[model samples]
Target: MRTTKLPTIELSLVTLRSIQKKDFKDFFEFGKDKETTEFLTWGPFKTLKDAKTMLKYIYFKRQQRNEPIGYAIVSKETSKMIGTIEYHTFNHKGNSCEIGYVLHKDYWKKGIMTEALQKVTQIGFEVLDLDKLVIKHLRENIGSKKVILKNGYKLVAIYEKQHFHTKTGQYHDVFVYEHWKK
Candidate 1:
């Protein structure tokens, strides 16, 4: 049975913690940024209500299932939610999971995501004992490609016309990366 629980991971520049209702304001701050959600499956949250609804779904519903271990990425200095990351699409029988993340555009290229991802990948392998972890991004998202590579993930596959961009309303190729426990 799956027994791993998402824990509050503290790092030098960021902390990955469970989402809170009180984070509504900060959540909306970045969730509404077009540039930040450009490559993400979900947002560009149109209203505060939308953000609240999403938080509820993320914190309550997803948690109850013990899947999609979600985290709110907070800046240590500002104590504000700057992004989110998660280990989702779990397959217990296969001991595998997919990693997903998004950061505020302002924090891009700062190595913040690299640090957060390294911590979460360690958690997936050492704590959860997962055998394989996968990460995928649009073929055009170079930033995501860098982050995946920096974490020692290898390009395992590419699916053509596999991902649909909500905003652009166009299908794009996706690159899948994976890391196996050594």
Candidate 2:
């Protein structure tokens, strides 16, 4: 049976657990913060319904397909959802997956993301049996790059002018990252 318990990832100031429907409110606040989502694929949520729908879809996907694992970062002391993370893009035949994460601005610079990434990467290689893992960050998202690097992912390539960014309405570069099982 699929586990109902959310995996725990501890950091200096917070913990990470599977994202839940109840976290929609906290997620809405974080996702709607322009500065917090400036480098994300989709964010700066326009409405509460938008955030709720997105979180619901993610939770449903986790329950149904067991892929695209999504988690909420929570403050350890307060037990409040503060952010999110995902391990997605499974390639069955290729024996690989990709990862991504986001943290609330209030929790930035506290090494929370780096700790979360380490745990997620361990799950990818150990539980998921992935042979390789990949990650990408918007070229200018320095915080994301730092977390990935701290978790042992190596810079691979730059997909220059790759995505037509919706927020900026222009092409942007993405830094490719990769990690291999030893």
> How close is every model to the real structure, measured as TM-score?
0.93, 0.91
Which candidate ranks first by TM-score, i.e. highest?
1
Candidate 2 — which residues are off by over 4 angstroms? 1-6
In order, what lDDT does every prediction score?
Answer: 0.87, 0.80
| TM-score, cand. 2 | 0.91
Residue 11, model 2: Cα distance from true site in angstroms: 3.1
Residues 1-182 of candidate 2 have per-residue lDDT tens digits of 12324466677777777777888898898899999998887889999998998877765476576564577889887788888877777676787777877788988998888888888787777666678999998888888888888989999999999988898989999899999998
Residues 67-160 of candidate 1 have per-residue lDDT tens digits of 6447889999999999988888888788998999999999998899999999989888887789999999999899999999999999989999
Worst 10 residues of 2 by lDDT: 1-10
